[model samples]
Target: MLRIADKTFNSRLLLGSGKFASPQLMQQAVAASNCQLVTLALKRLELDKPQDDLLSPLKAMNVQLLPNTSGAKTAKEAVFAAELAREALQTHWLKLEIHPDARYLMPDPIETLLAAEQLVKRGFVVLPYCSADPVLCKRLEQVGCAAVMPLGAAIGSNQGLQTRAMLEIIIEQATVPVIIDAGLGAPSHAAAAMELGAAAVLVNTAIASSDNPVAMAHAFALAVEAGHSAFTAGLAHHNNQAIASSPFTDFLAAL
Candidate 1:
């Protein structure tokens, strides 16, 4: 089970509800992924409206709605967005992301750490999306973040495990859950992250942009399970030289 704060989740795959062609497709993908937690961008929500069409279906599915500060450029902005999302969604679970640069969407680690400290003090379940720096991740955890989300690569880059070395270190040292987020374009990438002992992974663009999102979501779910199982089963040690699995014998020569 993946434990974040006091809540425990059976599924390790988290989904971002964006980039889908329609709300229906996104819903389908969510159902197919079997994710207990789904992230919704605060910028995409219409808080002033009586009811949101997009939110009703997701609520019906009974999954935890994780509101995010996607467009916040600073710590102050992220706090305001977090308050608004909490009010709108009626949930305190937040995915704190402060990316000042639009081109690469690289998460601002300083701003993220700042905001996480404030949010946790304000009685919110904070999960900050941050860079793949072990020191930064430790700082975020020290500030009481429920989990530290380190990137596998740039946001939506489809590059797999570009920061594998850093991620391994983060996972090794983290007391809190380390969720691999962003730039995971394929199921194999997700599996690799799980094999490295990530508590979970958050995916959006990969599944949303796929030709068959529902099927793709299912595939990712399977891959996460497979990877986690492999980790639990204990993988073989890395070796520079080859070792024979079968005994070499001269019995064939005698025959």
Candidate 2:
């Protein structure tokens, strides 16, 4: 079971509710993925509306709604967004992301850390989407974030684990869950992230943009299980030279 804060989830796959062709398709993808947690951008939500089209199905599925500060460019703006989300969703769980760079959408470590500290104090279960920097991840953990979501690559880039070395360090050092987020484009990528000992992975573009999103979501779910199972089963050691699986005894040599 994947445990974060006070919540324990059966599935380690986390889905982002964005970029789908329709709300129905998104729902299908979510159901196929079997993710217990789904992230919804605060900017996309209609907080004033009684029944939001986007939120209703997810609520019906009984999945945890994780409100995110996706468009916020500063710490103050993120805190404000977090407050709105808490009131709107009636949940203190939040995914704090502050990216000032329009082109790359690289998360600002400073702003993320600042926002995490403030939100934690306000009793929100903060999960900051941050750069693949070990020091920054450690600092975010120190600030009482429920989990650290370090990027594998740029947001929606589908580059896949560009910061593998840094991610390894972050996973090795993290006291809280280390969720690999962003730029994972395939089931294999998700599997690789899980094999690296990540607590979970947050995927958006890869599944949503796929030709068969529902099938792709299922593929990713299987990959996550396989990878985690492999990790738990323990992988074989890497060797420079090949070693024979069976010994070549003198009796076999006589033949």
Candidate 3:
């Protein structure tokens, strides 16, 4: 189980409720993926509506809600968005993401850290989305973030772990969970992340955008399990020299 801020989740695969063809399909995908945590951007939710069409179905799914501050460019704005999500969604858990740049959709380390600090102070279970910087991850963990979400690549780009080296460092040093978020194009990518010892991953565009969302979600779930199993089984390390399974002398003796 992955523990984060008083919650224990059995599934390491977290799903994002965005870019899906329909809310029903998203629900089906979530069901198929068997993800315990699902991310929904606060900016996308209709807070004013009592029964938001998109949110109602998600609520029925009974999975843990992870409301994100996606559009907030500053710490203050992010905090406000988090509060609104808490009130509307009835959950204090938040995925803190502050990206001022529209082109790359790169998370602002300064703003993210600041927002995480504030949210933690306010009794919110904060999971901050940040760059794959070892030092920055430590800083967020120090500020009481439940988990550090480092991008595999640019958000929604489906690039797949461009910052693999940095992610390894973050996972090695992080006291809290390290969740690989963004830029995972396929189940293989998610599996690769798990194989690298990531505690969890948040996937959105890949499964949602696939032609068969439910089937794709199942593939991702299986991949995550397989990767975790491989990690736990202790994969062999790389080496330049290869040793023969049976020595020549041993074979001759058998003969």
Q: Judged by lDDT against the true structure, how good is candidate 1?
A: 0.95
User: All candidates' lDDT scores?
Assistant: 0.95, 0.95, 0.92
For all predicted structures, in order, the TM-scores are 0.96, 0.95, 0.93
Model 3 agreement with the true structure over 82-125: per-residue lDDT tens digits = 99999978999999999999999999999999999999999999
- Local accuracy of candidate 1 as per-residue lDDT tens digits, 131-208: 999999999999899999999999899898999999999999999999999999999999999999999999999999
Off by over 4 Å in 1: 44-52
Question: What are the RMSDs of all candidates, in order?
Answer: 1.8, 2.1, 2.5
Model 1 residue 203 distance off true place after TM-score fit, in angstroms: 0.4
1 versus 3: better TM-score goes to: 1
Counted clashes in each candidate structure: 0, 0, 0
Residues 105-155 of candidate 2 have per-residue lDDT tens digits of 999999999999999999999999999999999999998999999999999
* Candidate 1 similarity to native, TM-score: 0.96
